[model samples]
Target: MSFLLRFIAECLFTVYSVSFLLYHRRNFLMKQNHLIFFLISAVINWSFSATWGLAISSHYGAPALLLIVLLELKGLYQMNPMQLLFESGYFVAVLYWGRGIVLPVFALILNQSVHWVRHNRFYYPVAWILSLCMILVYNMLFRHVIAPKAKVETFYRSKEQIRFVAIFQVCLLGYLLFINLGRYYGVDLPWYKISHIISCIICFAAQGLLVNRGIRNSSLLEYELHTELLQQQLERNLRHYKAYQKYAESFRAFKHDYNHMMTSVKSLLSAGEYQKAINLLDTIHETRHKQVPVQHSYSNNNLLDSILQDTANRCEEQSTQFSANVYLPAGHNISDIDIVRMFTNLINNAAEACAKVTSDSERFIAITSRFISHNGWLQIKTANSFHGKVLIRNGIPESTKPNRDFHGLGLSIIDETATKLGGIMVIDVDQKEMVFKTTLLLPVNIQQWNKKDRLPVRGG
Candidate 1:
């Protein structure tokens, strides 16, 4: 009966662990059905747990079982193998060490000997409760706090990060395996207990240090990404400025020749050549309309005007139906560079999505920005048409193009800019309509926004 109870408890723990893993990487696209997931998880977990109990010592069974479970979950979640390994290894370490810390401390407080507790009739229930508590607490902390900011893919995406994580896991596994070896050899009680406590502390401190280092590395990468964005923005603005300068020069030359052309038209009219004068007038009007400087401003702010105008020109070049209804007042607390980053990314993404539409008539992007001064809110809404499957991970769309080196940064920039402005962005897609829409809401009034709250314009 005791053996059966232990087996059941172990099996349940396996289910709990794998379920937590699936939930941890929930943002990854999952194609498996819920029933199938449960069935496969249970069958594999039960088979492994049973096999370990029958053929392997409990000291080596748990980690071996969990490692296999992690690999199995990789297929179900479509997660990068190294990421799954790193995450699963860390999770198991936490589980094992957590119980190591909790159980001993708990036993000491109750004045219960470890041997007596293990052999006691209430052992299964007490152990199960403790295990459940630790797993629950770990899951909550990881899901609510760590998972949100983890950037899980980054662990495997960067070679350096992967190498570090691999080394960390190896060290962790060695420590756990060493403890098991000590148990297998029947090491002296007090010494093993002391070593266990020390190992737990070392494990926790090592994890904390590595996590801090990873965060610092992530920040450095973000700075690099931001720098790249700013350089790209500058190049775009420079090209637009050059185009406007040429247009200005052409307009001045047209003005210089305007009087001469008008005099010729007047002379032709005076000579009773009505048709010839009419033709000349038509040509002059067409030239003025077609050859004049492009209007890039839809709002009162010059920075926004430049961005929208540039976006409009690109859309026109691609035969996309682009429309803008921006109404930012002259003097608000919004950062100019932040605004540039925001709209530049938004419009560029929309234009790119629209560009994929094979039918010219179907390619359209509409951008609207409105400010409610009384409410101290700014709203930007952009909608575009896209074809093909859209891949979104952690709420940001992934690049569909073959050359992804430079493509996927736009939406991330928009997200970062919105966050810096103390605003929220909402994205929604209508699959049937093939439309993607995103809304960014910000508090723009000086009363609601502090100048000091503005993020640094320097990319670094």
Candidate 2:
């Protein structure tokens, strides 16, 4: 009967662990065949618990089981190995702490509260139900409060953060080991229950401190990144404005010379010097072509066109070919800033990838957009040259930089913006052609523009 109860408890814990993982890592697990992974994890956990008993399994079997679970998750999810290890370690520590500290603490409280009543057959069942309720409440708190504040994905980005979390989990596991050792040696004292409650309080406080720190750090980092992006956008806008100013001045000069050049051609024609008239017309055309600033419009929307033009200039400087054929109509319901943010990242990433290609002829970036009036969806596609391996997870590419903490937010930002605007972003990598392609579908409703009337502005 004791073994059966222990087995039931182990199974319940498995359910709780799987629930926690699914809730926290839904973005990672949802794309993959995670049901089988969960089932296998539960089997491994239960088998160890049943064979060695809960106490022995937690102490002697957990480390090995952690290694197995880490490998399984890595193979299934293709997540950062370090991140996965930290996640697995924390879960194991929590399991040990709950078994050693939380359950016993609850049992102590329940025993004291029900001491006035006579012992009955329903007592154990009532206690088990209460314990389950406590677990449920904990899960709710974790999902709503703790997980949101301290996202494991954000927390595990820094090596220092990983080390900090590892230290906390190690301390937690060590404390549980000590408590288990006392139990194994029959070292229970009159004050043991009080110590258990106090230890639980200390553990909760420490975990809360860690979570609070993570929240603050993540928020600050996000704020800094946002400010930096805004600064870059401002600079790009300024450069675009200057380019327009130059073009306007050049156009004004050409207008001033137009009448004088036409008068000279008229004089030569009247004098019967047909050759002189042709030569004068040729000179005028050559001067206009040389003096005028060539402005290429790539989209109907002014801001988007400016961004594309600026990207084109940068691509030229970098010796990477850039082409854009976009027709974004005004008042598309999506905000201008969001449009800028999405396209800027998309173009910048493509340009960066193209710059990495060894062959100049192979370095190119192409972007095209189409609006499906019937579906009220705008489709945008970007293709660029890339020369290396790309690892994609959860529909986003992984950062290949040495310091991944700061380098991988571009695609994520674009994906997030697309999602918020009722759109989707898809990425495709063609190893055979050495091309990286991104397709985005954004919903837009424009009463003024249709498929037949829309004129795409194409430039390179």
The digit string of per-residue lDDT tens for model 1 on 1-460 reads 6666666667666656666656755445464575487567677766654554222225665467557667656656655555667666775666666656554454555566444454565563456556656666765765565534455434334435655765686578566656746654656366566677678767766775575566466556656766765786777778768888898988998887788999999999999999999999999998887768644456655567667667777788999887777766434556877877788778878887887899998998887776666777888899999989887765677787664534665676687668767887888988899999999987765464433432212110
Go through the candidates in order and give each one's C-alpha lDDT.
Answer: 0.66, 0.69
Predicted candidate 2 versus true structure: per-residue lDDT over 1-460, tens digit per residue:
6446555666675676567556545445343666787677667766764554333224566677567667657645645555576567766655544444444554465654222211223444344434545556665775567756336445544445655766676577667567656644554543665676577557655776775586567556655666776777788889999999988898889989988989988988999989999988889888888888788988887788878888989998888888998877543666877876788888878887887899988899998988877767889999999979888865678777775555576787788788778888899999889899999998887665554556655798
Error of 1 at 290 (Å): 5.8
TM-score of 1: 0.61
Where does candidate 2 stray beyond 4 Å? 1-15, 21-26, 29-32, 36-58, 64-78, 102-131, 149-167, 185-187, 190-193, 329-333, 446-449
For candidate 2, give the lDDT.
0.69
**Between which residue pairs do clashes occur in model 2?**
none
